[model samples]
Target: MLKIVYPICCGIDVHKNFVVATIATTDRENITTYRTKRFSTFTKDLRALALWLSNNQCVHICIESTGKYWIPIHNILEPSCQITLAHPKYVKAIRGKKTDKKDSIWIADLHKHGLVPGSFIPPADIREIRDLLRYRSKLVSFASSEKNRVQNSLTVSNIMLSSVVSDTFGKSALAILSHLLKHPDDQDFDFRPLLHGSMLKKQNDIALAIDGTINDIQAVKITLCLSHMDDIKRSYVARGTAF
Candidate 1:
């Protein structure tokens, strides 16, 4: 019987614009360093990488999980071969010169010697859902910021709407603002409807609040901000439909 050796194992160092690849062949017990390849963050580049690794008979790939940066490449390379994602926080550079090319090589060397530790990699579906949730959360944050801008505009224009209404987007408040947007100086805005419990007692103040100078520009800004909230709400609905 004859002895046979298997394929080489690879380590990849990923940067925003390029990646460095290193291959360790079992037969020679030596590392083969390849030239650096520059690639945009795109599916085509990743697919090309998969093809190259396959051509070189590389079976294992190790990469540092720099950020969400690693996921796209990780997903692409996974089915073609075994992949290990390293946590950069744990993989510190040696006390010397550090560059993307060198870092990639260093990471590959550690992986080749089985000295590197890989972090937890979530299943594909879980990672995707988490990304969507994060996006939705950011949209909600943007909506909140718009709401504050509207409140500040109203305050600047001497409208005391916030003092009585818990939310500027409440049924009565929106109705009033919607009317105000179209008719910036709509004096017929019914102040009585906005009053609640003891707020009814402050009818005088409520009337005075509305009685303040309603600047035309401030009114337009508030309406636009509120309209943006509507758009954000619609996006949230679309996100729910996607899941």
Candidate 2:
């Protein structure tokens, strides 16, 4: 015989705009009663749902993971309810007969017998850190892609800066590139002033590498790529500070 783990519990079917909730109350005689309600996904409606659950003395709640739709509901109910966040497969309803109310009821039935397993959710602080780190990672990836675009622009324009310097964006290379962009028509400008440290020894090679022509369009593309890379770097630093 199945054991009645929670004498009274609620199950929720989360959606983007709304949710359906059903409360299951089981009696000692093995009888179960259900009361289902629909609520909007807005904060006010979710608060009312929490209040309704509190009033019915139902603290154990089960809900299926449905994209980001379940996040707001979980946030609103986290303070007052013992929420069981189950994978959708664990609480799936019968095919061809699935309705919001029916799904909620099915979840409630599974939860009532302690048949539902909750997914592992880190604490609030850890979740916040995780989100920030993930966003920073994306920023780093964007910056790398922008750097690649800049390198491609240089390569197509016959700018062999990458071949002469270990880092094309290094101080000396950028100084030479900046001068080239500012004085696009003056190819004979001396490279000695831009050459620094060990780069001074490779002055001849560096000058030869940058001797190629860079059209107006290629120059503009390189400029835009550098600008975007700078923006991504700033965002990455800001996100790290937020962490």
Candidate 3:
């Protein structure tokens, strides 16, 4: 059971472009070092890395998670080998001069002594849900950005729609604002939606806010972005399908 419980271990210092690895033998006397190779986080790269680590007889591995950058590598290696995802904030090194190679070596040394503590790595299905949430967050951000751009365009053209209306994207605001963008004439500022609660007893201010002419090119760009945001939302709803 001694051989089964304790086996060869590796420590990896992962970065955006390359990975630094160190291999250590667990026998009481003989310690080995191999840190000259570099591996990528791509699928092919990870498969090669797993093969190499297997060849070297590394039973377990440790890595510091740097945001979303570490997940792909962890996912690739976790199925076939034992991997501990170390938290960067939890496992900080001494604040002095340090290089990538030296950091990798230090991590390996710590693992040999059973000193490093790892954070949680959820099951595969939970991980997939997390990824979907992450993508949905980006889509929400894109939608907000496009709305801000449209509001800024109106502001630039002397339209104070945001000042008079609670939401410049509301029914009354969109009715007038869309008309103005389609036709730059001030008369195109029709407040027909003000017949409903959108007016909110502020018909005059709502009409005043809709009188401006934006650059045609800027309007075109904002429209395309709005269209793209719609596409993103639809794609997210159909998440489980293969791309």
Candidate 4:
């Protein structure tokens, strides 16, 4: 019972490999005409689809957002048409007799009658910023995970480094750790060279902290953890310099 608002419009069901497009046009007598076509999702084919729509005088386009498959199509057709990016949940047809062709037809019918609601599509610059933030968040999470792994390796080896130093990865702490990992069996080791300024005041406490038992296995694991931490640190610095 809905009135036809767009006399000429297109609906596209997007997929990874291909897309099914349905163009609906209404005549002066209110009789509707539908032309269905299949096109590959490649760049040239998308251009062909856009050209076909333009030839049919299709101005308004309704395309269901199916994963990221709809992006390329939208980008290609955006300049020439008024695009309505419909959310799949709202545009999805009922289950029983569904096909990609039928889905395209259903979307066209809904859009032609002004029954489809468009989803919010952010501008390109905002989308780029959002993607950058997401990537940065992922990198930060990975760096935190590597830090936890380093702490876990120290804890399992019964090393009190974390308890003694506020930042175990600090210069003084890493120096002491490197010395201990190098001469883990040398009980008569001196902590003087590794101690500096404020840390030198806590020389006795640091000596006690480094006195914890560390087997060959723990030494190897800690060495690998420190190496991985260094890699993460360098990566973080590089990313910072990029922005």
TM-score for each model: 0.79, 0.94, 0.71, 0.85
User: Model 2, residue 115: what's the lDDT?
Assistant: 99
Q: How well is each residue in 1-243 modelled by candidate 3, as lDDT tens digits?
A: 213233477778899877877776655554455544578777898788888888987768888788778877887888788887887765567789998777776677666666778788889988778877877788778889988888777788778878987887776667776676667655654456444584768877766766666778777875776677668768867864622
Worst 10 residues of 1 by lDDT: 1-10
**Model 4 clashing residue pairs (backbone):** none
Put down candidate 4 lDDT per residue, 41-146, tens digits, no spaces.
9999999999999899998999999988999998899889999999988788978889989999989998998988999888878887888888878867876777
> In terms of lDDT, which candidate is stronger, 3 or 4?
4
Clashes of each: 0, 0, 0, 0
User: Taking the tens digit of each residue's C-alpha lDDT, what string does model 2 give over 1-243?
Assistant: 799999999999999999999999999998999999999999999999999999999999998999989999999999999999999999988788678999999999999999998998889999998997888788788888988998998899899999999999999998988888888898999879877899988988988898888899999998998889878877767755584
Look at candidate 1 and give me any clashing residue pairs. Answer: none
RMSD (CA, Å), candidate 1 to true, equals 4.7
Better of 2 and 3 by lDDT: 2
- C-alpha RMSD in Å of predicted model 3 compared with the true structure: 4.7
Candidate order by decreasing TM-score: 2, 4, 1, 3
| Ordered list by lDDT, greatest first | 2, 4, 3, 1
Q: What's the residue-level lDDT of 37 in candidate 2?
A: 99
Most accurate candidate by TM-score: 2
